[model samples]
Each structure stands twice: as structure tokens, then as C-alpha cells.
Target: MMQPILTVAEVNGYIEEVFPEVQGQYLCEHIAPMEARVRAVVGPQNLRPGGTVSGPTMFGLADCGFYMVLLAMIGKQALAVTTNASIDFMRKPEPCDMIAEARILKLGRVLAVGDVLMYSEGSDKPVARASMTYSIPPAR
Candidate 1:
């Protein structure tokens, strides 16, 4: 298999250059990977009253992860649009940190599909899973 020519630095650089605002509350790791992983230190800002990470927060995390992975492959394309999303909350997340591992299931000229499995830090079981599809804008 061919090694990915881009590194995390390059991918992150593109992200910073294109969608500076896409940077989320968590830090994204493993850019340019066949898959992407993001980690967040959970706090009141991301949690509900019962100490569970809020659904919206998890959704945001997975969304950002998907965007980042697609960008890593397609490069600095901020106009990519979300076409669909399906998320499942499988288990409760840790009250402290949440991690999402995302991979692209398909990458076509005009469309990209990906999924994310999120886990609470220190836990082996997934807390949630998100499947997303993105529409890449046709070349200008």
C-alpha cells in the first residue's frame, strides 16, 4: 500500500488555513491517517446533569472528526456539505474525556462517506457511533 503523502502537520495546517473555526473543543490527533481520532477532556461544558456527555456535544465531536478526515484526504475544502448523518448512542461515556475514532468508508469525486466510533477515555467499549455523508462541491 502507498503511504499517505501528507502528514498530520500538513493536514492541520490546511485546516487552520481553510476553516480556522472548525477546530473544536477537543484536539484532533492522527490527521492524514486512514482514520482519524479526536480526544476531548469532558467538563461541565460538555456534560448533562447526570454527568453524561450531551448528545449534541457528541454529535459535534463526530461531525468535526468527519470533516477533519475528509479534509485530510481532499485538502482545504471548507465548502464540503453534510448530506446525511445517523448516530447511535451505544453506551454512556466517561465523565472526564471522550475520544472519537473516525474512518472514511468511501471517497468519490462528489461525495464522501465516513463513520465514527466514540469511546469514553479509559474505556474499551464504544459510547456512540456516527455515520455521515458529505457532498464535496464540484470544482469551481
Candidate 2:
């Protein structure tokens, strides 16, 4: 059976209950019908000068996206911590919203890794790429 993905409503509830700031920064969307992966989008408030999305904006989205994904798969656990993050800014994103697609690369007892590709909304090219490592606390 395929794993279930978190719905936009569920994501919002999570934000309201734990990560309130994420609700305004990112919107969880259903990108594909078959894969059930989540796509997080950033709104205008996250923009920087020159009409491009800022690095910290993308990082926040990436970080929050991982947290959402992990909660979708393993259930909400607020203690998960971001242990490592390496991102490359390839190009300036267009003057619009930013999108990030995150998928888990590995999930073990203590660590979870995921890759995030960031792009400017309405653009076909990627603006950045990031890999994040999250440390999931041991089960109680």
C-alpha cells in the first residue's frame, strides 16, 4: 500500500498547533496524483530585494517541509531537530512565489534525510537545491 500524504488542512492544523509561523510562509499542495508528494510554496512576504526569493526563505520552507513530511509519515513529534543543511543557490528566482518539493532520502531510528528542490513560481528552472538532515528523537 502507498503511504498517505498530509493534506493542506492537516498541515495547517499542524502549524496552528506547533509551528504557527509556517502557516504564513508556506502552503502545502498536492502536486501529483500518483506519487502523493507535498509541494510547499512561499508567498510574497518571503521575497527579498531584486524580486528574488531569499536564501533564508527557502531554508525555512525546506526545514518546515521536512517537518511536515516526517509528521505525515511517522506522526507529529515536535522534538525532531534539523541537524544539517547544505544548500546551493543556482540562480535568482523570478519575482513571484517560491516552490519547494521535498522527499525523504533515508529514514532511520535517529536520523532522517531529505532533498529539496526550490524554484520560482511560474518558472520552469530550479533556483536552488538543498539537502537536509533531521534528527528524530528516539521513541519513548
Candidate 3:
């Protein structure tokens, strides 16, 4: 198995420097090989009608989680951009933190594909699943 090229702190630092707008919304929990775990801190603003976490919030968590995994394996390539994404909302997520487990399914020279499974905090059942493909910029 390939080891991660970046650490959680390093990845978080890069996000803080470049994507400051999402500073406290998403946090990298772990990175190992081609996998990463991320947490989305759910707040009142993240809830929709019925007091459940919104689909967009869960989608953001999956995107962030997959991005973290890709960056951990490929280093700080900030230009990597999501090219395609699809998500399935399985269950209503509670108004609490959401945990995302992301794994890289394939990594190529200019593209990477990954999937994420998200669950409400402290829950064993997944609330959503997402698959995404990112276009990696060529090295300069």
C-alpha cells in the first residue's frame, strides 16, 4: 500500500491558507494510504426543514473528505478540481456532526476518483454516499 505524502496537520494547514472560508467547517481526522476520514461540524445553519441535516451539507462533507484523501496522497496540489460528482442520500442525518470515510478508487496522472460514505456522528448506519472525480493539474 502506498503511504500518504502529507500529514493531517499539513493538509489542514494548506486548507487554512488557501480555503480559509471553510476553516472550521470541515476537519481532517485521519489519513492512511489511500483513505481519509473527515468530520463536518454541523451547526444550526447546516440544518434544513424538519431539523435534519441538509443534503448539501452532507455533499460538502463528502467532497471535502475525498479532497483531503487525494491531497494526502498527492501532496498539496491545490489546483486539483472536482470534475464530476454524484451523491445519494440514504437516511435523514441528525443535526450533529457528520463523519466521512473517503477512499481513493483510482489515481492517474491527471485524474483521481474516490468515494465517500458519511454517517451521522456516533451512528453505525451511513446517511449518504458520494462518488467524485477530480482533475489533477500537471506538475510545473
Candidate 4:
């Protein structure tokens, strides 16, 4: 397995620099080899009418988690963007913090494929799953 090029702190700093709006919402927890873990700080704004975490909130966590994994492997290339994504909402998430565990299944020079599983904090079962593909920018 390939080692990560960036540390958790570096990835978090890069995200804060480029996406200040989401600075405290998403946090990179850990990164190693082809995997990354991220946490989403869920607040009232992330809840739906039923007091359950909204689908969009889970989706955002998955996307951010996968991005962290990619950045950890490839360094801070801000231009890398999601090309495709599919998500399944497996269960209703509690109105609390959420964690996303992302893994890279395939990585190439120009594209990477990965998946993320999201769970409410302290839960063993995933509430959602997302598969994503990202387009990597050409080397300068």
C-alpha cells in the first residue's frame, strides 16, 4: 500500500485555507495508506423536520471524507473534483455528529474511485454509503 503524502493536520489546514466557510464543519480525523476518516459536526441546521440528519448532510460528509483521502494520497491539489457519485441511505441517522470512513478502491493518474460509509457518532452500523469518482488535475 502507498503511504499518504499529507498528514491530517496538513489536510485540515489546506481545507481551511481554501474552504473557510466549511472550516469547522468537516474535520479530517485520520489518514493512512488508502483510507481516511472524517467527522462532520452536525448541528440543528443539519437536521430535517423529523429530527434526523438530512441526506444532504450525510452526502457532504462522504464527499469531504473522500476528498481528504485523495488529498492525503496526492497532496493538496484543489482542482480535483468529483466526477460522479452515488449514495444509498441505509438508515435514519441520529441528530448528532457523523463520521465518514472513506477508502480508495482504485487510483490512477487521472481518476480515482472510492467509497464512504457514514455512521452517527458511536454507532456501529452505517446510516449511508457513497461511491464516488474524482477527476484529478494534470500535474503542472
Best by lDDT: 4
lDDT (C-alpha) at residue 103 in model 4: 96
Q: What TM-score does structure 2 among the candidates reach?
A: 0.83
Model 2 misplaced stretches (Cα beyond 4 Å): 31-45
Model 3 vs. true fold: TM: 0.98
Instruction: Give Cα-based local distance difference scores for all models.
Output: 0.80, 0.71, 0.94, 0.96
Rank by lDDT (best first): 4, 3, 1, 2
How close is every model to the real structure, measured as TM-score?
0.86, 0.83, 0.98, 0.99
lDDT, model 2, position 33: 19
Candidate 2 lDDT by residue in tens digits, 35-119:
1234455567667877777778778777776676776666667888999999999998776677777777777789988888777
Off by over 4 Å in 3: none
- Enumerate residue pairs that collide in model 2: none
Q: Write the per-residue lDDT of candidate 1 for residues 1-140, one digit (tens) a residue.
A: 22344566766676667667755465667864557787765778888988889998899878877877777777767799899999999987868788889888888899989899999888889999999999999988
Candidate 3 local lDDT, 25-130, one digit each (tens): 9999899999999999999999999999998899899888999999999999989999999999998888999999999999999999989999999999999999
Write the residue-wise lDDT of candidate 4 on 1-140 in tens digits: 79999999999999999999998999999998999999999999999999999998998999999999999999989999999999999998999999999999999999999999999999999999999999999999
Of 3 and 4, which scores higher on lDDT? Answer: 4
* Minimal lDDT window, size 10, model 2: 30-39
